[model samples]
Target: MTSNAPDSVERADVVIVGSRCAGTAAAVPLVRAGHKVVVLDKARFPADTLSTHVLVPNGVSELKKMGALDRILALNPARSTHLRITDGDMVVCERYKPFDGIDYGICVPRNLQDECLVETAREAGADIREKCSVESVVWRGGRAVGVVYRDPDGEEREIHAKLVIGADGRRSRVAAEVDSWTPYRGSKNGRGFAFRYMDDPKAGTSQHEEMGVYRAERTVGLTLPSTPEGRVLAVWMCPAEDVSGFRMDPEAAWQQKLDGDPVMADRLAGAQNMGKVRSTADLSSYYRRSSGPGWALAGDAGHFKDPVTGNGMRDALKHGRLLGEAAAPRLHDPERLDAALAVWERGRDLDTLSTYHWGNRESRPDPVSDLVREVLRTFAGQEGPDLSDTFNRARPIEAIVSPTHLVKGLVAALRRPGADRKAIVKQALGELPLEWHGRRNRLLDGFRSTRPTKTERPDWTVGNAPGPPSYRPAADPAPVGADVPAVAA
Candidate 1:
């Protein structure tokens, strides 16, 4: 194939970069709506990516809505129906509440999941160009119009489109080209992560279909049933500062970490390790501006949170579809398209802000304090809504464990016989600073603006758009992780 001349640029209604979850998802809706959709990715099908790979019920719903769930099911991935969380001697176990008729989580490997999504988009009429690298966005009159890319054959080509969507990962090339890579709000992730697969024929079977999460002094571990049947994904999360040591001897470090935790050790007993451990230390969370005049960012390209919550895949699918739906109807009318994109961005922020902050707090590399443990015990004993609902997005996280519950748990701990009253009081007092910071940040977020300012551009034209609405936390809200005892469900 020869490079196309600049004057012979190809065209499309929507050109999307990155063919994984977000990009493929966005393509389905647009192409089905009768638009010419082009999706590009630098990798071929069945390639792997760094991910925890757990999809809660809401994520399953998203897959079904996109018409891809059946394909995923055919892969024989394990269905996780229950969740178990352990901290010290406190244990909370519960079945996942049904959401949109979905009652289970799926832990499909990224290779299968992304390839399934790409196929789904292709079947829906999107032209998917694998192994195509996007070099830059095409600019005309201050708004994006298309992309300049290198095809797998080493031929350069141009695609001019009414809208360009960036569904690339955290370090999105499209976002960088559009100047939307800078996050407006962010927090340093406190933990590092590592995982590997194991042979577990009993996984996803009777009495073993539950996802296990174990929290120790400064670490967290997870056991999730995964694809190809009879296999499980084992994970370990520790302080970010400790990730370097694992790089030297990942096998030994992973084994030592698992052996140190009796719960993990028990779960992995008799299981055979499948390969070398995979690890990542760059888990910082943030929110970036999602859209502008002619370009939009979806998935981790726009917003990312710590993997501790295991909600990234769900958000990626849901928001990517939402963005496509929002833009499809107004593609011919640039003004309406821009307005719709802005609205979608605002809604995305409002929907995910709390979880973003909660993920940050949960990723902290501190031991679970006694006060928090007591609250967890109380919450486990008397729970109104199923904690699983939080993961399903059926209920707000704050509602799972309210401020009243926190106070009650504290008082109950103080009343227990032989309790260390002084230490309990001291622990509660020590949490005041964190609580104050959470409250203050919530307040400030409510008043802050998200609208981009207008400026003259020498390279292109500009458009006017409305600013996003402020985010207000629920009244008398508890600090991010203090009330949410279950790290993940």
Candidate 2:
């Protein structure tokens, strides 16, 4: 916790930008391994940010491993052991199966959750500088060496380090400076999100201990019991085309959408709104080039998925910690550091590809088809793999709903009396292309690697250097189906 003099040049083994989930998670591991780690952020702790706010069991496990779980639990956030999902006329309610001996999910706001992580990193011996803004990276011999930043006192300073990591979120300044802002694979999201808090009188009741999800035509609603007794977070996701109407009168729109879902409407009948509605329509998903000489990207800085899956925070904590663990031992050797970063990047892509596609499918504006409803009904009645395992990352999502399982569900539905066999067959035929595409992506990504080829590395020579691309969000957001070209394999 020592501060350097104003305008002085400092040095460290690793310099991390952004001190929230990913940066702090990385700093804890590096500092505990005896590396001189410096973490910087423009905002002070206990600050609010847009978030899903739900931590699946695996994310809670990461916090426990980092020794921050006790502090988080002290906040007294609501704990959910049961999950209830309602899609059209189908319903599935089940208790979460334990993963690594942990069984419940908790919803704590970012302000409290992030502060706990920051304190944990600081306690592990990382120098964390709040209200510090990094302006650009310093380069020498075609490699990143450090960063130029403005400290809290409005004085400009510099810090040289053996490795620089970007944990800064989706419009990351670090990612821009390193020329890694352009995503290699990207797609526009079909859904937009709006959320707010409510005070539920039945908070401590047994029914309130369950997390509820209602999926209706062109919309999805979530009721997650959150922190501060009697408070719950209500989230609504609607088709992108509906965002304009929502932006015009948010309160009315929020109420109207919730009322459209009978199940969610009944649950919140007596609840009181705690705040004004908050929302965003910029929910595109992408994966940027994550690593290069002397530099790397962690968390949303390098990859992002639509929040529909509610897995963003979990991946951020897990991968950020893994990045530090992989790079700590190789920092002393320039070549080894770069190689290690490339390896980590590849592993992360391989791990998340399935969920990325799954999220896109879940958030689409299409109405739930009869075939899909039957599939879910079949899954609910059967004795098989626990679907909750997909959320906890204990098993891949495809394993739970494989092609074989889908066929079995369809066959069972056809055998039912009064079934419209002709219509079901037609709908199943229409879905084959999408189903095949998803499976093909998983198979191909398994054999591919993220290691850079000779031409992929930047040519940082004096005259050949390219200026950083403007990575800022546009003034008017793009439409839902905007064209974004994907890189060829």
Candidate 3:
């Protein structure tokens, strides 16, 4: 694993750093296309990490496309078909309908989920190198062509590739080395998360599966079933100031908080704490520069939004695959590849910005305003868009919160008998400010001209590849160092 001789230099068509959802998802497409792909991860398999870990229907669909959804469900995850949200006095429950024969969200633990995706990539002919740390990006004349990594033995080796991908998490070393700056950084809310796992066999069944969100005063709690081990993740996202006290004695405090909510408390009345409590603070959302000369960023490495919306997994998995498909056709030419990646980056921004703003509002440490409460009351069975669509990102934000929709909703509220005109006025003022803030950013960003002028077919890169990527279906589908046709329209 030395670089002293040309023959000794480990080579691949694409070298992917980080083997979680993003890196593995990206590698699958290239490997299927018969490209030589090497995926490197610093961590060993079946390791745990902090994640909301709820896969809404949108996320499930992406896994389905990769043929991994069934495998995930085989782990006996609770299949949720409805979401029940309790916002102060108003209660709303909406059922989930099937999307392309798939319904329900699965909450697989990150450790098990990451293993499934990495194994999927291996099945498709990608070489997965675990416990390998990427020390630095290998740059040549301003373009990244490879990386310097340390294997598990702590021996340094150089890997050269036609393209290098940074699928690492939000704190991406690849992005840092490339100076990939953030164009927009969203506001940070004072909210922090404290989570714990429990054994709850009676959480719900598939036919009656449920996800519960309760917002009382300034505190919010989420309870969802996760993994085959009969574990459910109960999370409390409260003001940052309250976290230290909870951290002192998490189980006792968590139980106390749950006791305040009769419904959540009842569901967990007999459940036993399975592990120690974990917490995270200072959650800020932002989008980073996604692509440059020879390297492109995917997943959290490229862009990350708040986890409040639970769309991180979908974004990471879907966009990683899209990026790989986009680069497949133009991998040999840095110019075309960069252009395609630019297109992918733009699409990613457009798709996630609305959710990003929504997450900011959710993550805000301030008490849930009456105005926001009123809005949530409307997102129900009788009014507003389907809760699943709004929360799961099945539809764009424009569908739910357009100017026309807002005006109509306001008028409807004002017409109600015994309406508090003063409260209505305050609601409008409070909500519109954040809406305007998001609008201003979007407007400014729209005017910024970026990307190459030349346009090649971009749609084909989105899972529209010519055929099955690999020559075979199982492991080692292609011979070592196989080269397939360049993806083209």
C-alpha lDDT of residue 469 in model 2: 23
lDDT per residue for candidate 1 within 261-342, as digits (tens), equals 9878877888975766888888777666677778899999988888888889889999999999988889998767876777
How many steric clashes between backbone atoms does each model show? Answer: 4, 0, 3
230-262 per-residue lDDT for model 3 (tens digits): 677888888767788687988687777777777
- Better structure of 2 and 3 per TM-score: 2
RMSD of each: 8.8, 7.9, 9.8
Give lDDT per model, in order: 0.77, 0.76, 0.71
Candidate 2 per-residue lDDT over residues 219-313, each given as its tens digit: 98888888877788888888877787678998789778977888888888888766778888777776677777788889999888878778888
Candidate 3, backbone clash total: 3
Q: TM-scores, in order shown?
A: 0.87, 0.87, 0.85
Q: For candidate 3, report its TM-score.
A: 0.85
After the best TM-score superposition of candidate 1, give how far the Cα of residue 457 lies from its true spot, in angstroms: 34
